[model samples]
Each structure stands twice: as structure tokens, then as C-alpha cells.
Target chain A: MESLLSYAFMQRALLAGFLISITCAILGVFLVLRRDAMIGHGLAHVTFGGVALGLFLYLTPLLVALGVAVFSALGILKLKERAGLYGDTAIGIISSLGMALGIILVSLAGSFNVDLFGYLFGNILAIDPEEVWMALILALVVLITIVLFYQEFVFLTFDPESARTSGVQVRRLDKLMAILTAVTVVLGMKVVGILLVSALLVMPAAAALQVARSFKEALMISASVAGISAIAGLVIAFYFDWPASGTIVAVSGLFFLVLFQARSYRKPAQEELNERV
Target chain B: MSTNSSLIHVDNVSFNFHGLKVLQDISFSISPGDFLALIGPNGSGKTTLIRIILGILKPSSGRIVLMGEEVHQFTQWQRIGYVPQKATLLDPYFPASVREVVAMGLISLKRFPRLLTRQDESSIDKALDRVGLKGLKSRRIGELSGGQQQRVFIARAIVNGPDVLFLDEPTAGVDADTQARFYDMLAELNRKEGLTIVLITHDFGIITKHANKVACLNQRLFFHGTHEEFCSSQAVQDLLRGEHHLVCHRH
Candidate 1:
């Protein structure tokens, strides 16, 4: 276990895991509160088009993926506001369109040296130095944005009309949050892949919320839980020779189940207290 | 605060939803320090009118002016505060303290990323005190009673020190005593701080008692005037009294 730290790839993978966990955990709180989990999932799938397009065009996959994801997020926002479509409907349409486009593009570009399964299911061992740096930069951007607009985001999530009346520039803030979610989704695809990225973004936050006393505390605890799950999953996967992304998602799922059971146990006591009061 | 004349001016405003007329040729002006109660039955377009005033909805036919400027051109929302009809739509279990919720009112005033300042803190405290929830500032919102929760939302509205405040069915679901208290708080705020208030409510008795002006709405502008004028107007009296008779006869 100690010798694993000596290998550059292993170190890169660990660092990437830490950054991904932190980013996803923070983003998860807003996504879950705003009920935008499906949007994150949709954006993750939309990122596949970016990935395929990059491969076809011989450009950087991360940049193209980010661009496509951002565009999809913007598109969803526009359709919801201007076109009067419900948000979930917009996300559903975009997700299917993106996936169809990706499939067609991949098929058209035959003989390309791309592993479709790796992009779909993720391969944590592929975290090179360049990818690690990219993850770090994306995580930093997300963290700073969250800190900067913490109060605004909280207000908007709870009540958009009140936020707007209070002069929060709600539309602008909504756009910013959507774009940030897109960035996080694109980056998250590298670790959890499009198929399960929202799990990483949502599960730990949901679990942390079960025990937290306040929003701030929930965010902190969720980040810690996410980071722990990533590290533990990586170690377990390495030792047991299991699939990295699958093990990570499973670990997170187990944590959620445990938290759910704990909450259920406490419910009766809380109800008793309520009756006594 | 700007001592501008005619705080809100509605000029021949009309609204349609899917080509069905909702408000037709509605015109009214609310000056600073005015407390106006918008009384109406269900589907009377009260919410629509409020939304139009807040710039959330556009008038189909005419223009609205606020503080001598076109309403559409007004960009500074810090001057206005709004409490929605169903604050209950927010999840009760959301992890937010009363103070934290009130601080959200200051989101527009603060430059991004900065912590709350002394001024913001004092104003929030004052707003909470005004709403009679100063002692429960640390309490989580989920733990509060319905009336108390509404007061917290009111605190959030006033935290920005807004000049104009709009509340839709603020006393809904609250007990009679709590509703009276809520109105008293609004009255005190209007009298002492001179906050312009536009309240949408189904409670006509309270409106007749406390409101300086009243607007009876049902799709179009039924009537708009001072309380005395509204009570004297045959159309307005018929609307309210007819509804009252229907309820009494049903029971």
C-alpha cells in the first residue's frame, strides 16, 4: 500500500480522485436541492458528443467535451425559459439528442483508436499527469465559483422569485450554476463516466444531509464523505483487482444505505420527542 | 430612499393567457407609504397583476412605470421585495436557519463572495425583530410553525430594507390569532417605517379594517379606491357581500 504512492500513475489517480470527490460533493448539494440531478445526468451524456467530436477532429477531448457540455446546459436553460418547456423535458430531449449524435459520429469515424467502453464505464488507471492537472484546474474553478456565489446560489435554490425580487440577478445566477454544473459533469465523466456520474454528484450529498444540522455543515460533511469513498474505493479496487468506477459507485451506494438505515432508526425517537412536546 | 412621486404607475395594462383575457384596461398608481390590499376571489388575476408589477410578467397591451421610469427599463430589484403565495412549496427539511434564510435577502446587495457585514447583520436583526421572530433567529426554519415560517419569509423580505413589499396570501393556513398578528406587524411596518405594501388576500374583513386602499379584482379591474370609497361603491360591495352571502347560505 505504501509502495503504491511511489508510482506516478497511482499518485495521479489518487490526486484525481480527491479533486473529483470534492467537486462532485459540493456541486451535488445544489443539484439535489434544486432537483437538477437529471440535468447533471443529461449533461454528462451530452459530454460524450464532445468526446467523440474531439476524437474525430484530432483536438483535445477535455476542451471539446467542456464546450459541448456548456452548450447543452445553455440550451436547456434557453428552452426552459424562452420556449416554455419544463426543465426535465428540456434535459430529456437534449440528452437523447446528444447520445444519438455521439453514436452516429462514432460510427462514421471508423477505425479510430478509441475505447468506447472506457469512456462509458471509466478507467481510473488512465489518469496521467496531464489529466490530473486538468481535473485540479476544473476543481479549483468550481470551488472558487461556489464560494463566491454561495449565498446567491442558496437563495436561488430555495426560492427563485424571492431571490429575484431581492435583486439576486436570478437569471444570470441560474445560467452561471447551469454552466458550472456542465463543467463539473464533463470533468466527472473522467472518473465515474457518463453512465454513473450523477451518482458521484448526488449520493454522498444526500447521505450527508441525513445527519447534518445546517447547509454549511452538510456541504462540509458531504465533501469529506465523497473524498473518503473515492480513496477507499481506489484502494479496494487496487487490492482486489476490481473495476475502479464500479467499486467507487458501489462504495458510495453502501454509504447511502447505511445512512438511510441510521436515519430510520432515529425517526421513531424524534417522533416520540415530538409527541412529548 | 428616493422621495420620488408616483412609486408605481400602471397605464392601461391588459393581460391575456393563451389569448384568454385576464386583466383588461387596468390602471392604478401607488405612491410611496401607501398600503394597498388587493382583494379578490380565486382566479381573479391578483397574482398576475402582482407579477406584472414585479416585472415577472409583461402586459399585453400597455406600459408600467415605476419611480418615473418605464417598468421594463427598471433593472434594480433591490428596491422591491416579494413573498410568494406558497412558501410551503419549499421543502420543510431544508437545512437553513432563520438568520441564514433572512440573509438571503441581502444576496443582491453584496458583491459576490464577501461575508456578511455589520450593516447587513444589523438590518437582518432589525427585520427579524420587526416580524417578532428575533428570539428564534437561530432556529431552523423546519422547526417553526406555519405563522412563524411566514414571519421568517417576511423577515427575509425586509432584510434588504426594500421600499416596496408585495405579499401573496401571506396569512393563508395560519390561525386567526396569528393572522391578526401578521397583519398588525404589517400595519406597524407601514406606519412606522413607511414601507409601501401590496398584499393579495382573500380576507375582506381585515382589508376593510386595516387597509388604507383596496382593489377588488376579478379578471378585470372591478374597483380601485380608498377603503371608504370601496365600501360605498355598489359594485365593490356587491362583489364582497355577494360572496359572503353565498358562503353563509352554503354553510
Candidate 2:
């Protein structure tokens, strides 16, 4: 561990993991509860297109990915309204279109830019000071949005119709959530990569929900699961030379499996038997 | 009963969606301390009308005055509480404690960038106590029985201490005994707290017992009058007899 800390790239990787994991955990709680985990996957695919477009245009991929992701997120809302499609249909359409567009764009950029593989299966060690700053800014935005709209969000998350009747401005909150999700997805592409980003968004939250009885506890538990997995997974990867992103998501999934099994745990039944006896 | 303390006034209201006339030229007024039952046949615009009154949907034509302001311009939503139909429509697996769900009421009353104060906690406690679930505030909402879950939702609706409460089929899916008990609790709230309640229900059992006023609607204002008047109305007899009856009369 001490030797690993001496490497600047490992330090950068740890910071990147912390930023992505924490923000994803926070956003994931809402998304999982809303049953919109696919939005993360959809936006991540859109990020693929965004990254490919950036490569073709000789521009930074992260900024372009942000633009593409937010626009596509808003576009999903529009399609759901105008085409009268359910959310999954819209996401399916957009996500496929994004991947298709990305494939075409990457091919047009000539020679398939072997570095593009890094974005798919992430190379977290490649993160620089600029990507770290972007991740921090995005994390701040997501956390602040959650704090500002905490009540409205929880209301809408559980029961949107009742929320509307309570004058919570359900439509506005919907848009805000979609946009924030887009930003989070784009930022997540850094540490977890586009291919497995949604795993980071959903697994930790799902794990937390398995044992958490309250929303506040779920949030804290999810953040803990995600942050711990990210750091631990990255450290383990450093020793075994496994890919950081895959290792982190696998670890998150491991946490979920453990929590899922723990859900049925009850105090030793001897006490209950004694009371009944 | 005194009618001078009117809180909601609906004048010549009509609503339609996709060219389907859900309600036509319906009008009513809600007074403070009134336990009013909005009864109707299934799909008779009961929920729609309640939604319009709660400002969830706009009347296609007519105007609504709530708390002395036009519905469109009314901004004091904290003065009202709404418990929607199928309150249990949320997935049963969703995770939230009773306290967290009830505190959503106080949270909704807060504007952006504001934190919930200590007073919000006490209000939550009081609301939970009113629903008889104060002791189970830490329990998962889904862990409760169907009736207790409804009570938690009621607690959430009332935590804001609204002057007017609109409940849509709040006791649906419960057994008859539980429904009666639920209605009795509501009656206590109405009589003791003097909370104006607008209940949308298709069930007639509790209406005659608890509601002082009754509004029978089948896509139009069929009858709006005292419970005594409704009990004596021909429409009630026709409805009870299963006749293809459509009464458009108003009192």
C-alpha cells in the first residue's frame, strides 16, 4: 500500500475512483428507487457517441461527451412526450443510435484509434489533473442538486401523482433529474468507463437498499459500499494487475451479493424460541 | 351548518382530455370544517374533479378559486394536503421508513436551498401520533399492513397541517371493518381538528354515517346537497336499484 501511494498515477486513480463512486452512489439511490437505472446505461452509450465525435473533431472528449449526454438526456424526455413512448423505448432507441453513431464516427476518424478502447474498458490510471477537476466539479453539481431538491425529489420518486397534487412541480423535477443523471453518467465514463458505468451507478445502491430500512440510511450505506469498493478494488487491481474499472464494478457487485444474502438475516432464533417457550 | 367559511369555490367548471368530456359545467364550493363525500360511479370524473380542485389538472373552461385566489395564481399550496387514490401504487419493495415518508410533507413545504428545521421533526411526530404510528416511525413503510400503510400516507398528507385535506379513495382495498375504522379516524380529525376534508370514494357505507355533505357526480354535477337531502333523493333510490339512471339535478 505504501509503495503504491508513492506512484502519482495511483494517487490520481484513487482520487478519480472516490469522485466517481461517491457521486454515482448518491445519484444511484434516486435512480434505483425510480426504477430508471437504464437511463445511466443509455447516457453512457450516448457518451460513446460523444467521445467518438470528440476524437473525430480533434476536441477534448469529456466536454463533448457532457454536451452530447445532456442533449440526449433532454432528447429522451422529448421523445417520451412527443412520440408517446415509454421511457425504456426511448432509451433503447437513443442508446442504440448513440452506439451506432459512435461506431461510424470512430471509423471515420481513421484507424479506429486504439486508445478508444480505453474509454470502453476504462484505463483509470490515465486520468490526469484535468479529468480529476472535471469529476470534482460534476460531483459537486450532483450533490448540490440533491441537497437543493431533496424533498421534492423524494416525493416524486415514491409517488409522482401525489407529488403533483402537492404542488411539487413534478415536471421540473423530472427534467432536473434527467439532466443531473446525464452529467453524472458523463463524469462516470472517466473511472468506470462507458461500457460498465451503469454498474457503478446501480450496484452499490442496490446493495444498500437490501439492508437499509430508511432513505437516509440507504444513502449512507450506498455511499459506503460504493466508495469502499472503488478504493479497495483499485488497490487490489494494482497488486494483481487487473483492469481497474472492471475490478471496481466487480467489487461493487460482490458487495451487492453479500448484502442481498444479508437481507434475510435475523437475530439468532433461540432468543425468539425462548420468549415463546 | 354554517357556510360562511368557504375555502374553495368552483364556478362553472368543465374539463376534457383528448376531446373526451370528462366533466361538463360542474360547480361546487367547499367550506371549512365540512366533511364532504364526493361520491360517483366508477370513471365518473371523481378523481379528475378532485385533481382539478387540488390544482393537479386545470379545468378545461371554468374557474376555480382556492383560498381566495384563482387556482392558476394560487401559490399557497402548503395550506392544502392531498392523498391520492391508489396511494399504495408505489412498488411494495421501495425502501423508506415511516418517518422519512411522513417528513416528505414538511420537505415539500420547504423552498429550494432551505433545510428542514427542528420544528419539522415535532410536526412529523405529531402527525405520526395522530395516525397512531408514532411508535413505528422507524419501521419500514412496506413492513406495515395495508391499513397501517394507508395511515402512514395519511400522516404524510397531514404533517403539513393543511387547512383543507383531499383524500381519494383512501381506504380502497381494505376490508369493511378497517375501512370503518379509517373513516372513524377521519371523522375525529374533522370534528375535533375542524379540518376541511374532501373525500373521493365510490363506497356509500361511510358517506351516510360521517359526511355531513354529499356530492354525487357522474361526469356532471348530479346532486350536491346535505346528506339528509341525498338520502331522500330519487337518484339515490335509482342508484341503489341498479337502474340506468342519470340524474343531472343540483340543489
Candidate 3:
């Protein structure tokens, strides 16, 4: 492991992996609780169009993807609010449009580049040193925003009407959360690829929720589960020459399964205890 | 007519949803410490009216004055406590302690970078104690029974000590005994603690026994007056005589 860490590429991969995992974990908790878990998946499809546009324009695809994903996230929310479209319905429209745009852009480019596949299936070991710094910055912004508005977010999720009545500025915070989700989805592409980015944002949180007694505990447990999975996936992928993104998601899936099983067994005992009391 | 004594002043408010009129020319004022029971039949826009007053939904026409300020311009939201339909929107598996759920009421009172201080903790404790759920402070909110969950939301609403409280169908799922106790607690809050209340409920018993004011609505403000006046109103008398149900018969 030490020898593996000595490699510059491994170091960048591991750092980016851990940062992105923790970021996704925290944001994922909010999304899952708000029943918007599919937003990450929808935004990732939009990110594909952004990436294709960047590649065609000879610009930084990651930056373009970030811009496109954020706008699309906001658009999805607006359509849901103003047009009164259902959440999944809004997501479906935006995601399909994004995919169509990406298809057109790739066709206009005249050839499918090898680099596109690299993004479709993440090449985390090939992650640049600059991308590692970008991950760190993204994680910091997300962390700070959550810390500042943790109470408001929880309240909004629990009961939006009460939150709005209490003057929580629910709409503004919603846009902020969307932007952050967009950024997280874009950065997550580096770890899990566009095809699987939403997995990072979903599995760990769902796993944590299985046994968590409180919201704070859920957040902590989710972050720990995600962080450990990222590191473990990296080590396993390195030794077995497996795909890193798939390995990481699979590890988190394993965590969810174990927790789910444990919960199922414990529930009957808990019911019996309640009966006795 | 004086806005100074009124906690909420709803003036000619109208709302249209999907091109259907939900409320029309509704006008009422809730004075300080008044226990106003907003009674109506199902789909009579009772919830819609509450949402409009809370600024959760905008009226198509007319104005709402909250605490002498126009509703949209009023930013002192901590002074208003609202308990939405009891546990209707709440996820049964939501992971939050009783303390955490109650503390949510105080979030609006805080500024940016809001952190729960020691004072906030004691306020939560007091709110829980008032609702008789202080012993379950550390328990998961989802673990509580339906009645207990209702009390938790009430605690959350009152944790910040708002001057006026609005409850929408708060007794929908609870047992009759719990509903009675709930009204008693609300009456105590109105009489002793001086908290103004606008309760949306179906129980006529609550209106006669506890509520000081009654607003009978069905797409319009059919009646808005004291309980005695409501008891004697022709529409109410007809209803009580089984001419109709809760919806006041428009002449």
C-alpha cells in the first residue's frame, strides 16, 4: 500500500476519490431525504452534453460540463415549480434533451474520440494533479454551505410549509442546493464516470439511513461509508486491475446489503422490546 | 376594524387554482389572543386560506396584513408558528430526534451560520415539556405514536414562542381523547400563555367548548363572528338541524 501511495498517479486518484465520495455522501443525504435522489442521475446526463460541447469547442470539458449541469439543474427545478411538472417528469425532459444534444455534438465532431470513453467509464488513475485540487475546492464549498444551512435544510426537508412559514427562505436555499448538486455531479464524473456518478450520491446515504437513529448520525455514517468504500475500491482495483468506479459502487452496495440485512433481523427484536415495555 | 389589535388581517383575498376559484373575496381579522376555529367541509379551501395567510401561496388578488405589515413584506416570521396538517407530509421513517424536530421551529429565528445555542436547547426543552413529551426528547420522532407525533409538531411550532399559531387539520388522525386533550392544551396556550390561534378542524365540539371565534367557510367567508353568534347564525342553525353539514348554506 505504501509503495502504491508513492506513485503520483495513485496519490491523485486516492485524494480525488476520497474528496468526491465525501462530498457526494453529504449532498446525497439531503437529496434522498427530499425524495430527489434521481436529480444526480439526471444532471449527469446533462453533463454529457456539456462535455461534448466543450470537446467540440476545444475548451475544458470539465468546466463546460460544470456550467451546463448547473444550469440544467436550475432549469429542472424551475420547470417543476412553474410548469407544475412532477419532479421525475421534469428530470426526464431535461435529461433527454441533454442526451440528444450530446448525440448531435458527437455527430458534429465527425468521430468518437477515445477520450469520450475515458469519461464514460472513469479513468481515475489518470486523474491530473490539478483535478485533485479542484476536487478539494469543490468539497470545501459544499462543506461550508452545508454547515451554514444545515438546520434550514433539515427543516425544509421535514416540512416545507412550516419551513417557509418560519421564514427559512426555502426557494433561495433550494437553488443553492441545486447548484451544489450540479457541481458535485460534475466532479463525481472523475471518480465514477458519467454512467455511474449517481451511484456515489445514492448508495452510501441509503446504507446509512438503514440504521441511523438521527439525521446527524446518518450524515456521519454516510460519509464514513463512502470514504471507506473509495479507499478500499482503489486498493482492490489496483491489485486486481478492476475498474475503479465499478469497484467503489459495488463496495457501497455491499455495505447497503449488510446494513439492510442487519436492520431486518433487529426490527423483530425491537418490536418485541416495545411490546414488553 | 383597527389593524393595531389584530394579529392577522385578511382583506378581500382571492385565490384561483388551475383556473378554479378556491377562495373569493374572503375577509377576516384575527385579533391578539383570539382562539379562532376555521371550520369548513372537505375541499372548502380551509388549507388554501391558511397557506395564503402564511405566504406559502400568493392570493390572485387582495392583500394580507400580518402584524400591521403587508404579508409579503413581513419578515418577522419567528413571530408566527404554523403546524401544518398533522404528519401528512412527514415521512414515517424520517430520522430526527424529538429535540431535533422541535428545534427546527427555532431555525427561522436565527441568522446566518445558525447554531443551536444553550438558550435554544432550553427553549426546546420547555416546548417539549409544555407538550408533555419532555421524557421523549432523545427518542426518534418516527418512533412515537400518532398522537405523540402531533404533539411533537406542536412543540416545534411553539418552540420559538410565536405570537400567533395556525394549525391545519391538526387533529385528523388522532383519537377522540387525544383530540380533546389537544384542544385543552391549545386553550391553555390561548388563555394563559396569550398565544393567538387559528385552528382548522372538523370537530364542532371544539368550536363550542374552546374556540372564542368561528369562521365558517365554503369557497367564501360565509360566517366570521364570535362562537355565540355562530351558534345562533341561520346557516349554522340549519346545519345543526341537519339541513346540511358543516358548509354554510348560502342564501
Candidate 4:
């Protein structure tokens, strides 16, 4: 473990973990609040297509993925608005189609030097300097956006109709949120992989919800939990030669389970007190 | 009407949903300080009509004017406050306190990304005070009783200090005493604050006691006039007698 920090790649991996965890933790709060976890899943798969296209074209995968994910996000928003289809259904369709396209692109690329397995399962130790820069910039952008629109987003999540009547441009905010979630999910894919990104974006927030009494508190706790999970998972994976993404998800899952049990145990006691009063 | 000016004007508006007409040729004008009760049967389109007026839904025909401008063109939504039916439809477990919910009313007035200011905090406190919920400002929304929860929503609606307030069944599911007190507060707001009010309710007894004007709707406007005129109308009398079950009949 001592020698692990000496390697530049391991140091980069640790930094990447911190950045990705904080970003995912913050975005997860909104995703869980909006009940858009499936959209996060869908965006991850769509970003896979973008990554595949980047590999096939010999370009930066993050840029390609960002473009594809944003386009897909906007498409889903427009389709949902026009057709009145359920958001989850739209996400499912888009995600699967994007995945299928990605598979076809990977097959066509044939004999590439890129490690497809790294993107699929995530190899945090293999993160390059360019990818770290991408993660940092994306995290900064998402953080700024959240700070700017926190209140509007909160209102839109709780009661969209009331938000609109109160002069919140609900549709515009909704579309912007979708786009932001897509971008965040795509950026996180490099750290947690397509299959596990949604977990990073959901579980810590769910855990925070069990304990948090207010929105701001929930956000703070969630970010902290995510940061802890990422560092612990990375360290555990390093010492034991385990998959980093799987370990991170498992850490978050444990937190969620513990919080769930704690909440359930306290609920009946609180209700009993209410009854006696 | 003291020449104060009309705030909302509905002209021959009609709406249809899936080949069934919901509102037919309804016309009425609401002045700046009028407290109007919209009473009808369950399918009488009271909610629909309110949504149309708020521009949440578009009428198939006719026009609505708000503050001397077309409703569609009225961009200053801060002037209106609306409470929808079924507050239960919102997620109760959401991690928002009563104060946070009320502060949402001021979101539109601020530039994006800015935190709440001292003035916004004072206004939120005042709105909570008005709704008699000042002590519960820090309480989680899910922790409140039903009546308290409804009052929290009312506080949110009024926090913006709008000119007009619309409530859809604000007292539904609340106890009779709570309902009575809620109306008293509403009446006080209307009379003392000079706020125009439109309430959609199924309770005619309360409507007759409180509303300055009454509109009876049964998929169409059965009557639109003063409370005395509504009570004297033959169609309204038939409605009160349960002759019209297609639309909600307010006594």
C-alpha cells in the first residue's frame, strides 16, 4: 500500500476517484430526487456508444461521448415532451439503441489497441492524464451549474406545476437537468464504467436520504459518503487486486442497506410516540 | 366595483377532451378584489377551467385576459399564486423543510445561482406567520399533520405576495374546524389584503357563506353571477337538488 502511492498511475487513480466521487455524489442527489435513476443508466449506455465511436475514429473518447450523450439527452427530452411518453421508457429505448450501435462500432473497428474491457469494467489504475483533465473540467462545469440552479431544480423536482405557476420555466429547467445528468453520467463512465456509474450516482444519495432532514444536509452527507466510498473502495481494490468499480458500488450498497435498516427501526418508535401524544 | 379594474376576464371559453366537451361557452370577469367560488360536480371541469385560466392548458376556443393582456401573453406569472388539488401527489418524503418550500415562491424573482437573501428570508417568515405556521418553519414536510401540510402549501403560494390566489379544494380531507379556520384566513386575506381569490370547491354551504360571487358549472356554466343571483337561479336550484350529477353541483 505504501509503494502504491509512489507510482504516478496510482496517484492519478486516487485523484480521479476523489473527483469522480464528489461529482457523482452531487449529481446522484438530484437524480434520486427527480426519480431519474433509469435516465442515468440510459445516459451511461449512450456514452458507451460515444466512447466506441471515439475509439473507432481515433479521437478523444470523452469529447465524442459528451457530444453523443448531450444529443441523446436532448432527443429524449423532446420525444418525451412531444409524445407524452414516460421518461423511463424513452431512456430505455435510447440507451439500448445506443448500446447496440456501440457494439456494432466496436466489431467494425476490429483489432484495435484500445482495451475495451477497461471501459466496460473500469480500471481506475489505468486512468491517463488526459482522462483526469476531462474528469476535472466536467466536474467543475457540473458543480457550477448545480450551484447556479439549485433552488430552481429543487422546486422543479418537488412540484413542477407549482414551480411553473411561480414563474419557474419548468420545461426549460427540466430539459437542462436532463442534459446535465447525461453529461455527468458520461463523465463518470470513465471512473465507474457504464454498468456501475448509475450506482455511483444513486446509492450514496439514497443512503443520505435516510438520515438527512433537509435538502442541503442531504447533499452534504451524500457527497461525503460518496467520497469515502470511492477512497475506501480504491484502497481495498489496490491491496486485494479487486475491481475498483465493483468495490465502490459494494461499499455504497452496504451504506444504503445499513441506512435502510436504521430508518425502518426508528419509524415505528416515532409513530408510537405520535400515537401516545 | 370601485373602478379598481378587472384582473382576469374569461370570454366564451369552451374546452373538449377526447370528443367530450368539458367547458362550454363560459364567460366571466373577475375584479381585483373579488372572492369567487367555483362550485361544480366532480366532472364539472372546475380544475380544468382553472388550469386554462392559469395557461397550464389551452382552451379549444375563446380567450382569457389577465391584467389587461391576453393570458397567453401574460409573462409575469409572479402576480399569480396557485395551489393544485391533491397535494398528496407530491412526494412526502422529499427532504425539504417548510421554509424551503415557501422560499421556492421567490425563486423566479432572483437571478439564477444566487442564494436566498435576508429580504427573502424575512418574507418567508412573514408568509409562514400569515399561515399560522411560524413555529414549524424548520419541520420536515413529511413530519407535519395533514392540516399543517396544507397550510405549508398555502404559505408557499402566498410567499410571493401575488395579486391573485387560486386554490383547488384547499380544504379537502381537512377536519371541519380546520376547514372553517382556513376559509376565515382566506377571507381575511381577501378583505384585508385586497387579494383576488378563486376557489374550486364542492362545498356549497361554505361557498354561499363566503364567496362574493358564485359560478355553478356542470360541464358548462349553469350560472355565473352574484351569490344571491346564483341562489335564485332555476338551473342552480336544479343542481342543488341533485338533478345534475354529471357536474359538481354546489348549493
lDDT of 4 by residue, A1-277 (tens): 7898898988998898887888888888988888787788898899889889988898887788899999999888887888888989888888998999899998897645646677777777888998888888888888888888899888887888888776777888887888788878876787788888888899899999997767888899889888889888888988898988899889889988888887776543335323432
Taken over the whole model, the C-alpha lDDT of each candidate is 0.82, 0.85, 0.89, 0.83
Q: What is the per-residue lDDT of model 1 for residues A1-277, given as tens digits with 9 covering 90 to 100?
A: 8977877777888889878877998989888888887898899889888888888788888789899999999999999989999889999999889888888889999745645567788877887788888889988999999998888888888888777666667889889999999999887888878898888899888887776656887788789888988888888988898888888889888888887787666533334323432
lDDT (tens digit, per residue) of candidate 2 on A227-271: 999999999999999989989999999999999999878334333
Each model's DockQ score: 0.43, 0.45, 0.57, 0.53
Candidate 3 clash pair list: none
TM-score of chain A of 2: 0.94
Off by over 4 Å in 1: A111-114, A265-277, B1-4, B245-251
lDDT of 3: 0.89
Docking class of 2: acceptable
The 10-residue segment with the lowest total lDDT in model 4 chain A: A268-277
Top DockQ prediction, candidate number: 3
Off by over 4 Å in 3: A267-277, B243-251
- Which 10-residue window of candidate 2 chain A scores lowest in summed lDDT? A268-277
> Of the candidates shown, which would achieve the greatest lDDT relative to the real structure?
3
Task: Give per-residue CA lDDT, model 2, range B1-251, as digits (tens).
Answer: 22245799888899989999999998888888988999888989999998888777888999888888888788887888888887856566577988988988775578775477898889999999898888788877776766778888989889988898899998878778778778889999999999999999876767777888899888999899888888788877777676433333322
Model 2 reaches what TM-score against the true structure? 0.94
Q: After best superposition, candidate 4 residue B243: deviation in angstroms?
A: 7.8
TM-score of each: 0.93, 0.94, 0.96, 0.93
lDDT of 3 by residue, A105-215 (tens): 999889667878877888889999888888889888988899889998998887887888888888999999999999999989989999999999999999988888788
